[model samples]
Target: MEMQPATDSRLELWHELMQFYIREAWLLDERRFREWLDLFTDDVFYFMPRRLNIHRSEPERELSPVGDLAIFEDDKTYLTMRVERLETGMAWGEDPPSRTRHLVGNLVAEPQPGGEVKAKTAFILYRSHHETEENVFAGYRDDVLRPTAGEWKIARRTIVLDSNVILAKNLSVFF
Candidate 1:
């Protein structure tokens, strides 16, 4: 589908929104979960769908639907649980403690109907550990952002991973 041209006002708003996302990325890379949570709205939907391998002729929808293969589909409550688990040492994945760095760029923000903006950004996530050394997960995040209470909050996020196969023991990092 063709993108709708952004108006001058909308373009300005989109620029601010992109900066907001960059800050959020910084917080996450710094392991600032509480601060990261602050950026989300009460009804935010943060999610990552599992990328899978299928025949080249197969339609993407038949292979991986947004609702079906999600590594995460979280609201504020669930996000809180995840954070709590990480904090209390119950999350085994973090027991060994993997360090991660997320590099996000190639942001494209376009205005949508109903005071919403649709944005897509390319990301290359580098994750390292004392045990396994290093691995990378590269993808594009498709987001639906809306301005609320003087801040931009993600209403929805869909992560499309570049690789069909995953090598990490588990996805503990928020990409």
Candidate 2:
């Protein structure tokens, strides 16, 4: 995908892409896992690498996604299994279900090399379980979206969380 000149039409396209993110957030917040899964491509690579706060002198080793730990490194198959588990209503972590709100903003979209879009967005997820205090997670996501059947589908996602240490007990909800 060659770089197109910025124009009013490009702005409109960006707005449409933003709408996709909004819809995705809604689906997740509503616990419509199946619908949310539909937004992803069959070859989606969703990852959330570990965020480490190290010495500034070794900035190169701060964040590692390769040969290191990660919160999530899921392919489409794993994502499907997660959704199926949720549907079974037997996932101990989410059996009671958590009330969640997903807020997405600061979206920026750029055309990639193969008719794909590289989009970045800021996200904040709030979750309230039965009798537990609300848990808040803040992060930013870098996504590669492919146009499929006249709609955009997430092909890849790399989420970088803001916190170095997660305070939540279980990360059952999608960020």
Index of the highest-TM-score prediction:
2
Off by over 4 Å in 1: 1-11
lDDT of 1 by residue, 1-175 (tens): 3545778876787578768878988888888888887776788888877676766687564336656857778888988887778888777777667787888877778777887888888898898887767889888888888888877887888787877667777778886
| Shift of residue 102 alpha carbon in model 2, Å | 0.4
For each candidate in turn, the TM-score is: 0.85, 0.93
Clashes of each: 0, 1
- Candidate 2: minimum summed lDDT over ten consecutive residues — where? 1-10
Stretches of candidate 2 off by over 4 Å are: 1-6
Score residue 76 of candidate 2 by CA lDDT: 98
Collision pairs in model 2: 1-113
Candidate 1, pairs of clashing residues: none
- Lowest lDDT sum, 10 consecutive residues, model 1, at 58-67
